[model samples]
Target: MTIAHQPLFKLCYDEPYLQGTLIERNNRFLCHVLLDGSPVSCHVPNTSRLTELLVPGAPVGILKASNPNRKTAYDLVTVEYKGTTVNLDSNLPNRFTQLLIEHNYFPEFRELKLLKPESTYLDSRFDFYWERESFLAKKDPASEPVNGNSCLYQADTLTENKFAGYIEVKGVNYVENGIAQFPGAPTIRGVKHLHTLMDAYDQGFDAAVIFIIQRSDAHIFRPHETMDPLFAATLRQAAAHGIKLLTASMVVQGKCVTPTLEGPTIDLNPV
Candidate 1:
């Protein structure tokens, strides 16, 4: 695929994000921030243990919660670090990747015509399910060419004879010395995803895991062996088994986030 000179995706909020100072993190999903000189509880969007980024008195950006029934009145989304804005939202990576696939950003997915998000395979639910146009046309010659606007084909309806692929997406925010690493905390589910991808590859289906680094400062991507050795080992095993491992860096400007034209290089070697 050609280099993307434009923004891959833009995450706009309904209201302007509020600037605040982070006080402390209470748990995985909760934090306290000083907004407008008042301490208020804010919802943390990420589940990972962001130990490095959630320091006390750190500058942060938050948005007002739209749901009236919600407990927290604001959601912490962005953190300023070393002159770079790092996005902490865990849900943005999948949406960003969906836009990338729709635009044919990855060469491996150029031939694929349709995309289904949150697709189930076996006991795991992958982030994306892609179908090739040629395969769809050959399966049903009377049907029109499959496009993004067409209805999504159910995974249950698809058989092994179909040509398709599965993609799992991971979001990254932790960076050290210009290297982006994944899984700030130990994650059992992450290792499971890697194993599932390997299983799909063994079954003759294309499988890949894309890591979206939510900061532009990272020049390379690698697994955080110190933080989670199991996850790192599984990632290496998946790579050895022919599962595609990809990484991309994103730049955050004000309230908008965009992918860089040139993606980051992946390094599987232990640090």
Candidate 2:
């Protein structure tokens, strides 16, 4: 009915677009493409190491730039490999998850109030912060409002403990075989976030890290250990210390996509 009560955004990239073959990635943000057999420069939205997905001659989907003065006339939207589409925009994952959580799509996070966006904790700024308050019954006799599928009501409440939560979102595009891995390149920032989450978890707060796999090809999720073993080790330690790790895959429909979470098997100290 209202914007605040709206549903989670469904995957839908419903726009006038073009199909092209990727010719070459000039750098992190620019790629040469063959559109209708004519060479053109396209903007690659996600700068991560697209490892196996951005092979030359791969089918790519692009959205025409509305800005006439822009250097590149198209924004590379998706790369198709064996019928799978990866959202090439690194910027969309966090915003998409925010839409999901605000619309109560996540069962684990539903009813948890969205306190702030880009909340800072120590040196890191998280994607979100939610409040989870548990009231004391003996201290009061009246009821208060609550939201959840399980604990939708609270009665005879008094001030008790309120926990602040943090969510860090990671966009995952690099998949090997059937497994999705992150940090397609070495990331000093990612390692720092894992350690921060672990520290927050130890500080009596609910802390979590979410990996939004940009495509559906991955059957499992793990750290790209071979690429960044230090980060992988830190992530493993965080999980062992009770920091919540979530893996959700996007269901992309022509650029419109919603996330679907899956169970993860995170292996650290792998043999």
Candidate 3:
């Protein structure tokens, strides 16, 4: 999915955190400039991954989210500290969005009639639409209109209609040292999407959030509570309320992405 907002910092150099200190520690580096002025800290999710790109004395962007729960005012979302000024690899979450929509992992819903391949909406494009038909109560021959031939006749096609749905997909890649997990940090946006799906269900449509695990090591999916407790709570709520959550394990090497389902149906009903 597209970033709803822009970056807050340009680079990490001259940032308050590294103001007068020279790089002496093993973990610390003079990486880049933080011109976006977004309040930032070292403990944020996905931020640590940029260390490979944050070369000494380069330029990068820092965006801060206003979170009371955050230790620092900002969590670094992007960087241009590497050789190239633009880092396109930051869009991993957006790339696998379609795989999330089509497989009903998130119970993501969309109207089949309104869907087109690569159709863009809500800042992201989804996969194929999911459609299902629910039939009305069984028809009775005795209640049918009488035909002239003494045979009871009824309409073969019921007036009942089909249900439509829509959804956006996101790929999770912030697994640490090979452990596949979601929300390397607290994601308020993810919580918001869970709420959106719950609302969609109330509106008489099926909604889902599909997570495509790009690594082979992860055999199951679980909310990252340490990163974002609210997100985990919302996820449990979505399951209790009938929202569909799906996880697909995949093997990704280079540009190839293959699907492999290895878990039971995502159980949402409360025990």
Candidate 4:
């Protein structure tokens, strides 16, 4: 219930999740719950450890799937811990980042155009693709910086324009003492993303990875090297290769998400 004065946004599922108490996580993708003192099986949306959030008898919110033919009708989506609600949907981060870009939340990308989602490249799928027209700061009508001042160009003019090859979004849930860490478990897919991001950069197009902290507790974001050293090493190499890194700390207000507090530059030093 922490409030802020920045622009706000939220993602409401098909319907508000039904209140329930977490009986137990039966498996990585399933769980048992108590809704109104009756036992009911539910679906766990994410596969991460979520060690700090989910607990026996903890308050939870379950989403009811429309298809009644499914094994479990409800999908566990939200969990409350230490007075904060954490979103557990594994597929929501990309959508949330898309909305943020559309709203100009990141001033660096405010002028982005031709935003595309779910772009598939060679052996890899990215979250977004976009183009931005940038003109050289002209002291004269030449292709050079004019005392580091910029000028504008038409949308049709591709000269000096930057086409972003890919943008990958990562969701963060593991947090402690205002520090957010990623990859609650080892991730091979994540290592692939780093290589792809670097490849995109080498292809003469913009590329970056964005990490969205699903809870309000984290003040900064860092890689969980202990959990996945290979991903950490690849991430460092990707950074060295000029792959951009962006982080945002977002809060869940009831069933909605507000404009995130964009995190500072990442701490690449291995921990």
Candidate 5:
């Protein structure tokens, strides 16, 4: 599908982001940055390894914490790498997916309204719970048409009935050679999410996982088999079970995050 370049979400800050240079990562959630020649602690929003993006002396954009009582006064939000601004916020993908669904960006999500965010299933809380308006209505055999023009019917071949489903969103920042990949490090939680989606599909509900590449340079997306072989294997299994795998790339310019005109294609199996 072709979509015009439009800002889906804006990264707003009450105070202007401070320009800084990376010093070192103290831990998974904390890092030290040289702001104005002085080293200061900053909060890292993502838990991934990010070895490619968070190298020492790399330029970064950090936002000061709103709360005065916070231990770390700044949050590292963006990293400049090879002329591309990569957003490091792990929470932004869900928001982007929500906006995309509201805008009817995905054909499978057409006519489907978001019922709730962070909706819970058996053992996992999904990013979204969505249902079609017709799904809530009583099923009528007489009202059903022999053939339909809706793309939902054509895309999802599981059921003729209306769509209702759970979606899990993943934010990807690691890209190499124009290919975006997820789980920069091993993630047990990521594997669990795939299992939850497969279980949802078995329960007769539409289940999907949407990966939002947090950079514009990527031409396609694939599971990081080398980083986390277990997660990659499970993702392949989920796709075989009819769980939808969706992806899109975004361009981050300053504070505005916009979707590219052409979305990234998914490559489940990659050499």
Candidate 6:
């Protein structure tokens, strides 16, 4: 997937309201520039989740819409804090991103697995699994070829008829100015999830922390170090421990959104 005809907008710091003022009117708002210097606005749709982070003087990314009837002139997209502009309202975006990487539909993924309590422990049924295997096939003249090939037969590649590894998925919503960031707010739960992935790696299972970035403009992704330092630290630890850290972005197609992984990984080593 590709981002076509991305509009270029400016950071209107000259305007009085743009100069670190809050949105007092009904539909207006101030957004922040992302880590990559992109404009974003915290609009009404995102107000409930963004109000706390979008305080005065918060730098944001703004996209000027061509539609005159739209309530706000600019879309409030992200907020900058502690030298980082956290992308607010990333929930839906994250979901779309995950779909691109894993190719799992939203509905299928939700009901794909359930955790059942077994002996005081919650056992989770993973969404997917992976492994490396070699194929052993024999030529049979009477066999019909699969996919228009008449000579060979394709078969499942596994050992003892069981999967070799298990993996879980997590969606991410956080971006600014086309640059994706995670945890629009400080998320203790996110930190815990990283720890869980680390645990899975230790327990001989292949695990990953997937960030599905919502916005098409984000060229890259990073963890929100400013919002939650602990989460960042744990993410680094997860990487070091071999919990594959992955990311994918979403493509807006008409009224629908699709996930696509093309953005580079964010490196936030503790510094």
Error of 6 at 139 (Å): 28
lDDT of 3 by residue, 108-203 (tens): 343232333433223333443334432123335466432232221233423323244445454554444344455655677778777866765665
Residue 47, model 2, lDDT: 59
Q: Give lDDT per model, in order.
A: 0.84, 0.74, 0.44, 0.76, 0.81, 0.47
RMSD of every prediction = 4.8, 7.9, 14.9, 7.0, 6.5, 13.1
Better of 1 and 4 by TM-score: 1
TM-scores, all models, native as reference: 0.88, 0.81, 0.47, 0.86, 0.87, 0.48
Model 4: per-residue Cα lDDT over 122-180, one tens digit each = 57778886666342221235444222322222222333244434689998888877778
lDDT tens readout by residue for model 6, 1-271: 8667432211122222232333332332333433233334435435333544555555554444556686555554444454543444433443343344344332222322222111110233333443333222222446554335332232323234222334444444555555566666677666766676565555454465666654456676777777778777788888888876766555543223444435556666544
lDDT tens digits, residues 1-271, model 5?
9765556555454556888999988899999999998999999999999988999999998888898899999999889999999999887788888888887778889876445687777778788877777664533434432123122122232355536778999999999999899889999999999998887787667899999999999998889989999998999999999999988878887555777766788888755
Q: Which ten residues in a row have the lowest lDDT in candidate 4?
A: 146-155
Per-residue lDDT tens digits of candidate 2, residues 88-152? 78877887778777776666687664446676666887887666544222323334433321222
What would the TM-score be for candidate 3 when compared with the true structure?
0.47
Candidate 5 vs. truth: CA RMSD?
6.5
Q: Worst ten-residue run, lDDT, model 3?
A: 16-25
Candidate 5: count of backbone clashes, pairs at least 3 residues apart or interchain: 0
* Model 2 ranges with Cα > 4 A deviation: 1-9, 13-15, 133-162, 261-271
Candidate 4, after superposition: displacement of residue 137 in Å? 18
Candidate with better lDDT, 2 vs 5: 5
Instruction: Tell me the lDDT of model 5 at 101.
Output: 80
Give the local distance difference test score of model 3. 0.44
